[model samples]
Target: MIRLPENTTVFDDGEAVARAAAGHLRTLCEDAPNQRFAVCLSGGSTPKRLYTLLARPDYATLPWSRLHWFFGDDRAVPWDDPLSNVRMVREAFGTPSPIPETHLHPIPTADGPEAGARRYEATLKAFYGAETLDPARPLFDLVLLGLGEDGHIASLFPGKAALDETRAWAAAVPEAGMTPFVPRVTLTYPVLASARSVLFLVSGAGKQDPLARLSQGEDLPVGRIGGSPLWFVDRAAAGA
Candidate 1:
């Protein structure tokens, strides 16, 4: 088996992982030098719990006004669809959240995955105020990611052409490797790497094989992520 990175953290279960992630997010926001903070969020059942935890009173009082939210990836579905990542996030936050409506940027899926990818790329560039990414500047303060059972991160499935994307900020996946099998729009590896930190939230026994592959140094899609990534996993997923 591949060795677990030094940055890996194992929890008793999914709930503990979520609590820790919520606390870390607050700290990152609090520590940012600039008033504005950009965070890229991942979509999955694991991260859903973290989002819900953040909505709690203890974590909800963070500087929501200064925080700008972006999605790392999104399925090509209407925002109101049951499978929509934006809808999941909105539901997790519940009503009357302090986070401003303008701060929450969701990938537009009404126009199809290819068009949606282009639109989201434009949105990221506009927010970053430049057509090209500057590694020194870093596009996001923190990017929260989730690892799929198939070893995919965000929507960058293994063997997908999107994994080869080196310059584009975003790209469209015409087909997904797993069920739901819907098209998707995702930030490219370059864009994901331009972050101060990338946190992978992994849970459930289903993730064990992927985690093992990662530990064995297999060049999976998740491994393509540049910079150091901290993986927060539960005992079951970690095989601890």
Candidate 2:
């Protein structure tokens, strides 16, 4: 485990982290002043539990009609593919969930990574009602993120060219640092930073090395995220 910042919260395990994240997310939705609220969802195993919990009674009652869902990143694959983040999220939400179909904004993967990224960028702009992002007016009410073992966030891998993106809200990764090396489209740091809140969920003993590196201030891609991120970590990841 690595040293955590003052804003970090340590949990007994991954389930505990998921529960806390769900509670915090619900609060964010309930407290939002706007009738329409946008939330950027995280991809990876860590968030599946949170999504499932949200589908359950305690959170299923949230104002799904007013909430808009967006993905932080997605592999360039068909929506129904087993490796597709969209598929994972859909299954986790379960059938007959209250979330509106039109409100779930997925990155279009029909035309490969580059085209998909461009299309997604347009979608985000349309939703944001502007081509350029304004710092004062965040694009999302909250952005959920996960820390990769290599210190990547979303699909922004460490030392990748995508990490340098500043102007574009979204970009394509021709190659990934890890397996399933398929192309991916991810929201850039600038876009990710334009959020009311950025939350990081870290779990498992396998995450210890990367967390340690982050704690030591290694300037990895995850560390480049703009806002003061809130971290939800399990004891195994925190080395508590």
Candidate 3:
């Protein structure tokens, strides 16, 4: 059985998890001290629901103008591909979404994973206005993450060299740990760690083992996340 961390918040179901995550995001945006709030989005069914909720009229008060959206990882496929995180996000938000076109920064993957990773890193550096990350100043206000059954966070899979990367803000995963098996570009740990808040949204019974391993003090990629990360999981994922 998984012994959930003290920071974990168990929800009744996946829908409740999405709702609570939406609320947490709203609070974070509202309370942000900076004029511009950056958010790193995660990809998954659970987060897709959260993104859809944010795009709805009910979340109109979320200050869309000041909030910038970014992706933590994406497959090296066309933006419109079904497996593409960019496609999923665009479809979830629907037409006439409040987020400005310039505000949604998708990882560039058309030029292949290597160049795409480099370009995306440049984009992030430009947005941060500095090449070097300062611990005192975070690159993002909130970062949303999902726990893979293999304990991978973003595209940094177990035993992958990307897990040891300490320089670049983003790195290319030429070979993924699992399907869709396409090449991917992912933000490195330092970039992810440079967020004011990191929230892991996990659901489904399949996630129980990973959570259990984390509880047992296994050094999964998720464990390397800084900033005192919090977990928001459904009962099934918590091994309830």
**Maximum-lDDT candidate:** 3
Q: What ranking emerges by lDDT with the best candidate at the front?
A: 3, 2, 1
**CA lDDT of every candidate:** 0.89, 0.90, 0.91
Q: How accurate is candidate 3 locally (lDDT)?
A: 0.91
List the pairs of residues colliding in candidate 1.
2-215, 2-216
For model 3, what is the alpha-carbon lDDT of residue 121? 96
**Candidate 1: stretches off by over 4 Å:** none
User: In candidate 3, what are the lDDT values of residues 1-240, reduced to their tens digit?
Assistant: 589876899998888999999999888977885589999999998999899988888998888888999999999999999999999999999998789999999999999899999999999999999989999999999999999999999998988889999999999999999888899999999999898889989999999998889889999988887668888999999878
Taking all chains together, the TM-score of candidate 1 against the true structure is 0.97
lDDT tens digits, residues 1-240, model 1?
235666998999999999888888888887885579999999988899988888888875788878999999999999999989999999998898667999999999999999999999999999999999887999999899998999998999989999999888899999998988999999999999899888999898889998888778889998888778888989888777
Q: Cα RMSD (Å) between model 1 and the true structure? A: 1.2
By lDDT, is 2 or 3 better?
3
How displaced is residue 111 in candidate 3, in Å? 0.8
Please estimate how well model 2 matches the true structure, expressed as its whole-model Cα lDDT: 0.90
Name the regions of candidate 2 deviating beyond 4 angstroms: none
Locate the minimum summed-lDDT window of 10 residues in model 2.
Answer: 1-10
Per-model TM against the reference: 0.97, 0.97, 0.97
